[model samples]
Target: MTWVVLTGRQNHLDQAATPHKVITNRDYLAHPALFRGQRPKVINLSNSYAYQSRGYYASLLASSRGHRVIPTVETMIDLSERKLYEHALPELELALNKCRKDLGGSFPAKAHVFFGIGPSKAWDRFAKLLFDWFRAPALEVSILDSGEWASIRKIGFCPLGRMSEEDKKRFLDAMDVYTAREWRDSKARTPARYTFATLVDPHEELPPSEIASLRHWARIAEKMGVEVEPITKKDLARLANYDALFIRETTTISNHTYRFARRAQQEGMPVIDDPLSMIRCTNKVYLNELMTANKVPVPPTVMIAGPADFELAAETLGFPLVLKIPDSSFSRGVKKCSTFAELKTLASEWMEESDLLIAQKFIPTDYDWRIGVLGGQPLFAIHYLMAKKHWQIVHHKASGKPDQGGIKTFTLKETPPHVVETAVKAARCIGDGLYGVDLKETKDGIFVIEVNDNPNLDHGCEDTGEKDEVWVRLTQWFLDRLERQGR
Candidate 1:
C-alpha cells in the first residue's frame, strides 16, 4: 500500500470517481491509527487568502504519524509579497520527496493528505519562506479557517519536545537524592573539633580536685573522638583557632573570656558558655524576670528599686523573706529577713551597697533541685541538701571551719519528679542549650529559684553511680552533632 502526505490546502474531490479516506480532528482523536503511518500532500486552491489555515493543518498532521508536503505557487509579485508561496515551500518539497520514495510509486489516492492554506501578501513572501523552511512535518494537511496559521505556529509541536512528565519527575527526584548524598559525604569528610582556652587565676591556682576534673574532661573528650586543647590566659590568642571556649574561673564580661567568646561568635563559631549567657546568669533580677515571663513558677518576689520600695515590699511579702543583690551568685550577698524591722534595716544596708535588690517569699524548703541541661535536654538532676540549723546551702561563718551548710547531692531517681519536670521546663524556657536550673519544691508547686549559665562540676561529690556514663553520653552527643554539621 502507498502513503501520501499533503500540506498547504485541502481540495474537494468527486466521491464517485475515487474512494476518499478522510482524516478529521474527531477521527484522529477517536482512532489515531487511521492517520498513523500515512503521508499527506497539500495544494493551494484559493487565491488572495491569508496564511491562517496553517495551524489547523499542522495540528491535524502533528497528531498523526506521516510526512507532509506542500506545493509552491509562485506569483509575479516580489518574493516578499507572496506569503505561503514564499514560506513552507522548501520544507514541503523535502517532505514530499521523502514521502513519495517511502510510499513507492504514485501518490496514494486513498492515503491521508492534510493541508493548511490561506492567502498571502507579496510583502511577506520572504519571511513566510523562512518559516516554511523550518515547518514541522505532519501526516496530513487541511485548509483551516483564516488566521489559524499564526495560532498553529505558536502552539505547534516541535521535534524536540521534552520527555514525558513521569520521566522528568523521576529524573529530578534522582538528582535531589544524589545531591543530598553528596552533601552528606562532603560534611563527613571534614570533622569539626573544638579548642578550649580556660582561664586559671595565676594568683589563685586551681585546686587539685578542679585540675583533676579538667584532666578527666579532656580524657572524656578524647574517648568520645573529639579533639580538645586546654590553654591558659597567657595563651588566650590561641582561642582564635577554636570552635568554642570555656572559662574555668569566675570572670566578668570585661574580662578575657568575654572577649574570646565575642570574637569567636564574630568568626562564625558557635560559642557556649557565652558572654551574654554569663551576664544573664550573673544577674538575679534578669533571671527572675525571664523565669516569671516564661510562666515558670517562682516565689512571690518584690524588687527594692530603692530604700522606699522596701517598706511596701515588707508589708506585702511579710517577714521571713529572702533578700539578695542583683548579680550575686553562689549564695553570696544573700540574707534572710525574719521581721519587718530586720527587713527595713537590711534594705537600708543593701541600698548603700547595691543599687537594686530582690525580696522573695521564703518557702522554707529544705532541699533544692539542681539540673544540668544541654542542647535543651535535661542531662542530669540532683538534690542539694542544706546543712542542719542553716537555712541556706552556703554559710559564711567567721570560724572558717567546713561550714555545716555545705551542699550534699543526690541522683535524679532520688530527686522528686515534680522538681525534675519544673527544672527541665525552666531550662527549656531559658532556650540556652547549656545551663543549670535550681528549683525549689514549694507548697504550691515546684518553682525555679535560679538559673546558672555555667554550672560547676565539682569532683568528689555524690556520683549517683552514673557520673561516668552521663558524661560519656553527653560528650558523645556533642561530638556527633558537630561531626554531622561539619562544624
Candidate 2:
C-alpha cells in the first residue's frame, strides 16, 4: 500500500493524481491497517521538529515496520536535536563569529537569526520561536528545510528548515549549491530496467569469485529485466532513484554503507542489510539475547561489563573462553583466552571501546556450518573450514597478518535437515533478511556461534554448486518483495 500525507493546509492537494492512500498527521496513527500488510509507503507531510507531532511518529512507525517513509523521521529528529548539529555548529559558529567581529563581538537588540526547513511557511514558524531572543535591526537569519539537503550528516542543520533569499543572503550558499548538485544528479540519472544499485567499497578490490557473483546477479537481473549497478559512498544521495538496493560490502554503524541501507529503506526501496537487520546482526550482545529468548540453542555465553564480572565468568564459563567485542567482522576482535591473566588484559583493552563484551564457551569445531538464509528460509549451505592451526575461519594475528579459511558449498538438497533447521531458527531471531548463520557440529548438539549480516558470497565458495540458483533466488526475492509492496 502507498500513502501520501500532506500538511493540514494542503490536504487532498494531489489526491486526484495518484491512487495511493492519502492521510494527514492526525490519521496516520489513528488508522489500524496503516502500517501492516502490503508494505505501506507513508509520506509524512507534517513538521517533524515538534516533539509530540503526528509527523514525528509517522516516520518512526513506518521505519520500524521497514516501510519507505520520507523526511525520515530519524533524519528529522536528528536535525532538531543539538547532538546532530555537531558539524553544523562549527560552521554556524564560524559564520556567526565572522559576523560578530564586524559588530564588536556583540549583537544589537534587533538581530534575529532565521533557520528553516524550506523557503516558506517553515521559515515563518522557526522565526517565531526565536522572538524571545534579542533581534538586531536589519539582521535576520534564514535557513531552509527542503528535500534538497537529504543526508543526516551533510544535513546536520536540516531540521532547522530553510529561509527565503529575500531574508538576506547568508552563509548557506555553499550548502545550497551542494544540495543543488545532488538534486540535479538525482533528476538526470534514470534507470531503464528495474534498478538495483549494489553498494560496495570501490577502493577495496574483491575476489574474482565474489566479483563473479555480482556478474551472476547482473546476468539474473538482465533476464529478469532488472539493472544492477555498483555504488559507493559517493552515490549515496541518489539512493532514492533506485528500485532496490543489494549491498555487497561489509557494514558498520560508523560507515557510509549503513547510511545507504537507511536511505534505501527510508525511500521505501527493498534493500538488503536493511538498517535494522544490520543493527541486530552487527552486535553479538543483542544476538545472544535474541537467540536465547527464542529458545534457540546458542553456546553458553556471558556478558562482561568490567573486571568485576570476570570471576563469575571464570567460574561459569571457565578457562579458555572466547572474548568478543560487541561488534566485529572477519573474526577480528574475537580472542581465545586460555588463562585468567589473558582474559583480564584483553578485556581491559577491548573494554576501552565498549563497556560490554561477549564471552562464549569455546566450542571446538573443525568447520562451521554457514547456512545462507533469506526471507526466513534456507537459500544455501556451506561448510566454512577454520584456518589451518587457528580456532576460527579468519585468524587475525597480533602482527596484523591474516589467515583465511576454505569454504565448501552444498546445494540446498544436499545439506543436512538439522543444520538447515537449526540455522533458520537462529537467523529468525534477527530478521528475515539475508543472513549467514554460523553453526557448530559439536558432541552434544548443533550450537549457533553467531549470525553474520553480510556473509561471504565469494564466487567459488558459497555460490559453488548452486551459483546460478543462489543468484537467481536472491534476485527473485527483490521482485517478490516489490510485488508485495505494491499489493
Candidate 3:
C-alpha cells in the first residue's frame, strides 16, 4: 500500500492565505489510489498552526476509512514571524507553560519543533536548532528526503545535501561488503582474499631492486598462505575493500598515514603501524618521555623549547651535543653542535622550522644498530654505519642517487648483545605489534636512539646468510598472527 506523507504545513485553497504548495505537491505525487484500489494513507507530521487544515484533512480521511486518527498535541509555539529576539520571549514562555500543563498526560518526553517559514538565514538558525534538538536518541525527528535517506544509510548524514545517488550506492555497497566480510566465518568456508594499500612517496617510488624485494616478500607470503597488496598513497582509497593494512613507508602522525589509519579504524580494519603507534614514534619528545618513564636507557637529552632555551640546554647538557627536530624521520632534521655559538645558531634555525627540539649528548659512536621488532620480539638487527664523512647515513645530496649509503646491513649475531637486549626492551616498552628500535652501543652501555613505527625492510638487508631463514621467519610470523586473528 502507498502512503502520502505530509511534512510541515498544508496548502489550504478555501482561505485567501498563501498556501504551502510544496507539501501538497509531495502528497499528490505520492498518491497510491491511482495505481490500484489501494488508497494512500495521509499522515500530517507538523508542529505549526499553518498545518491546521492538513490535520483536519487527516482526521476526515481517517473517519471515512474507519482508521484511528493520530493527532499530535501542540506543545511548541513557533516564533519565526516575530522579528526581534524580545518578541520571541513570550512565545517561548507560552510553550514552556504548555509543556508544564501537559507534563504527565499526552505530551512526549521531549517536544522538538522547527520554527521557520523558508530556507533562508532565519531558516538556517531554526535548522541549527532542529539538528541540535533532534540529535537526541530518545526523540525521533529527521528532515531526510528520499535521497537524503539513502545517503544517511550509507556514509552518514550529509546535511549540506551534496551527495549524488551514485556516490550513495557505492558507499552502501562497500559498507555491505565490509559487514558481510566481518560477519562471515572464515573457518566455515574458504578465507576471503582482501586487499591493502600502503602510502609511499610519489617522487620516491620504490626502486626496481626494492620492488623485487617486495615481490620476494609476496612470494614468501604465498608460501605461508597469507595475501598482501602493496600500494602507494594515490591508490590507498581503493584499499577500502581490504581487511587490514601494513604501511611500509615512513608515515608520520600528521601525514596521510594518520588519515588512512583513522579510516581503517572506523571501518573495523586491522591497521598495522596504526595512528597511535605513529603518534608515539613520530614525536621524539613523546618517545623520550616514554623511554624515561619505562626506565629504558637513553642518551641524556634536554628539550629546547625555542632558541632562547638553547643556552640553558647547552649549560645543562654540556657542549658537543646533538640537535634534532622532534618529528623528523630519516635523519632529516638532525644536526651536531660542537660549540655554544654553533648550538645557538643551529637552535635558531631549528626553532624556525619546528617548535620542539631535542638536544642530547652526542654518542660519539660510528654506527647504530637498527633492530626490527615484530610482535614484541627482535626479528632482525642490522648496523647502520655512518658514511665516511657524514654523521648520519642518510645523505641528502646522495638521496637522489640510485644507490646511497643509507643502511649497511649486519646480522643480529654480529651486533652487541647489549644493543640487541636494549632494542628488544625498548620495543617491548612501546608494546606495539611492529616497530623498529635504533640503539647505539656507547662505551658506557647501550642507549636507545629512537623507535620507529614504520621501519624499512630493504631487500637483501634481512638476509643473515642463514639460507633465507630471516625471510622465512618473518613470513611465518605474519601468517601466524593473521591465522590467530581468524582472518
Candidate 4:
C-alpha cells in the first residue's frame, strides 16, 4: 500500500515511500529479500526494461512477496512497449483520427505523451489526456529522435536523457499543468492514518448475519484504532478519504461494486475484492481455465463454443451435467440438463449473453465446503448444505430467495488439511486478496467447484469458532498493508 517511484534518475516528488536507487543507477542490486522483507508497494516507471533493469527487478521482486505494483511486471515487460504497438496502437490511432477531425485535418506533427514514468496515480487520465489533446492521427506525433536542437516543451514525459536547465524547467512546469494538485508526486503523502470505508448498499436486503458482520467489522476496526464508516455507491468521490475500502456488497463486473474497487485501486487504497480478484472469481469459464492451468482438481468441465462442441461436451461430461453461465452467482443462471434436449435448450439460453458456456459433470454431494480465504490464508471454513430436494446451496427453483440449507462452521484446524490447502492454492492463482473457495467433498476426491470473491462473511456463520477474530484477522491485513504502505 506504500507508494514510491522507480526511475533511472534522481527521485523528484515520489515520496509516499522512500525512494531507493534503481539497479541501473545503483552501485549494486540489493537482495530481493530486502524488498521482499519491506514489501512496500511500488510504481514502476523506470526507463529501462532490459533484463537487469531496476524497473523489471523491482516489479519482479516486490510482486513475488504479494506487494502491490502498478504497471505490474506483466504490464511493464510484456505489455508496455512490444505489446503496446499490437494492442494500444489501434486505439491510439483512432484517438488521433478523432483529434484530426476536430483540428480540420491537419494533425500536429508533435504531441506530448505521458509515459507513465512518474508517481502520479492519475496515469489512466494522463493516457486519456494524450489522446484527448491530439485528436489527429497519432502516427504523425514525433517523439524526440536523435537530432539535438534548441527545444523546450512543457508536458508529461519520461526524462531518460540529460536535459538543459531550460528544458528541465519546462518539464517541471508541465508536470504541474498536467497533474492535479492532489495527484502530483510532490503532494503524495502517507495514506490516511486509519480512515477505512466499507462499501455497502444500505438499501440491499442483507441477511441478519451479514448485517451483524458489518457491525462487528466497524466495532473491531474502532478498537484497532481505525475509523470504519459505511459508504454506498453514491459516496464514490469520497473514496479518496479512506485508507482502505472493504466491499461488503455483492461484486459484479458490471456493477457499482466494480467501480468502487477500481477507484480504490487507482487511488492506491488498500481494497478487498480487488478488481483482479473480482474479475477472476466472478466467472466460471475463467475459473476453469485458471484451475486447470494450476492442476487443481475440478469437475470434468468443458466450455461450450458451438453446437458441435455442445454434443462433444455432453458426450464427455455425460448427461445430467451442470451448465453454468460464466457470470452466474449464488446458484443462479445454473441448470442441470438431464437429457440432450434440456442441454440444448439451456445452452441456447445461456449462450445468448455469454459467448461461451461451461458444462461440468454433476457430482452429487450433500454439502460443499466454503473456505473463506483472506490474504492468501484460510480464515474460516463452512459446510454449505444443499437446499432440500436441490443439488446446490441456493435452489433457484423454489420461489423467493430460493430454498436454503443449514450452515456448519469449522476452524481451519478442524477442517481437512487438503481442503484448506487446496482452497488457498486455488484462490492464490487468482491473486491473493479475499475469496470463498467452494470445494465439493466427493467420493473421488475434493474438487474445487468455484471461487467466490465476495464470499458470505455473515455473523454467527463464518465467524462460528473464531467470532470477532475473523474480522480481526481480516482488518489486521489492511492495517498491516497501511503500515507497509507507510499509511
lDDT of 3 at 132: 27
Using lDDT as the yardstick, the better of models 1 and 2 is: 2
Score every model by TM-score.
0.55, 0.63, 0.58, 0.62
lDDT (C-alpha, whole model) for all candidates: 0.52, 0.66, 0.55, 0.67
Which of the numbered candidates is closest to the native, going by highest TM-score? 2
lDDT of 2 by residue, 403-455 (tens): 88887778889998998999999888788789999999877999988898887
Position 16, candidate 1: lDDT: 34
Model 1 per-residue lDDT tens digits across residues 314-348:
78788789998887756768889998888888888
lDDT of 3 by residue, 228-248 (tens): 556565443334435466666
The runs of at least 3 residues in candidate 3 whose Cα sits more than 4 Å from the true structure, single-residue gaps closed, are 1-202, 205-209, 398-403, 406-408, 465-469, 472-481
What are the per-residue Cα lDDT tens digits for candidate 4 across 122-183?
A: 22333453433221101113422223221212222243344445444544453333222221
Task: Let me know the TM-score candidate 3 reaches against the reference structure.
Answer: 0.58
Residue-level error in angstroms, candidate 2, position 67 = 19
Q: What is the lDDT of candidate 3?
A: 0.55
